[model samples]
Target: MKGIDQAMNTLPCQGCKGLCCGPVPITGKEFKKIQKKVKTFPRKIRERLERQPRFFGTCIFYDIEQDQCGIHDVRPEICRAFGYHKELVCFRKPELATKEKISFKESPVGYLSIDFTWKDF
Candidate 1:
């Protein structure tokens, strides 16, 4: 596992607003595993996982009010591996991390790249 992944697993997500939960990607196996676990998967979640290794916006399992994952235990590999290398970014409101610029040396997944631009979203 990469240093970022390891850090994510260990570090506490304090005051997070589920920014990372937006547009998460998962493998087919992971998707199937998730489907089997949830009794009733939300339409958005089903659509996202229907296609293998696709980017889906705003994880259906995320509790907006709580600002946390509803299914933390069964979250996808990509979700599990996501974390901040340094400081956290409030992606929902880019202005929060204005002074901080989050950049990736490479894509988290070999084929997928995270389009994290402050101005964009």
Candidate 2:
């Protein structure tokens, strides 16, 4: 998960920064969402994480060992939000980020060019 900590290079699940590593404050609603995923309530999860405070880390569902999650397919909403910040989308399947845009043209050439070309910097 390169976006896990903004790492330019991708990392293996086991090499990942763990599920709860960094500064990510959680609201009451967010807390409830996390509880639902972890199968625990807010009261029990109020304590700081083993390595860092809860306010400064990723979701508890993130698996540091495999660098993956035991509940990735059914992760909480907050985790979903992490993959999309503003207009930037970090799609894991594609392994890259994509900027959003609206265009009048969808293709060119045969069907219209699906490929995009831009001048180099």
Candidate 3:
């Protein structure tokens, strides 16, 4: 049995399909919305794509082979905004390397404390 530290450390996202980083095969309009919001409007952004309908081909920045993002330094804002802030969404939430040891979950709704009752003495 693995504890949270080990379970969290072996997270499969880097090796598994990176659904979060992909262009998401967005509709033309949705792509436009993302492009508009993420900056680099129309032509400039369009030029980066393999086809007008495809968001820079069927690939994400994450180098699946290496289990990491290839261009993480230049990753988009949306990717950066995937998680929450100043709040814990779940008990197993990833530990933020930046913040103090503040974690949470969505069990008791708005805000809840950890349920330590499950632990055996």
- Cα TM-score of candidate 2: 0.34
Query: Who wins the TM-score comparison?
Result: 1
TM-score of each: 0.45, 0.34, 0.31
Model 3 bad stretches (over 4 Å) = 1-12, 24-58, 85-121
Q: Could you tell me which residue pairs clash in candidate 3?
A: 90-105
Best by lDDT: 1
Q: Across residues 1-121, which tens digit of lDDT does each residue of candidate 1 receive?
A: 6987656445344566554666765555555555565546576654444332323455555655555665677776656545432344434343333334345433432111243211111
Displacement of residue 87 (Cα, Å) in model 2 is: 6.9
Q: For model 2, what is the alpha-carbon lDDT of residue 87? A: 33
- Between candidates 2 and 3, the one scoring higher on TM-score is 2
lDDT of candidate 2 over 73-97, digit per residue (tens):
5543434444334332333423433
Question: Between candidates 1 and 3, which one is better according to TM-score?
Answer: 1
Worst 10 residues of 2 by lDDT: 112-121
For model 1, what is the alpha-carbon lDDT of residue 28? 54
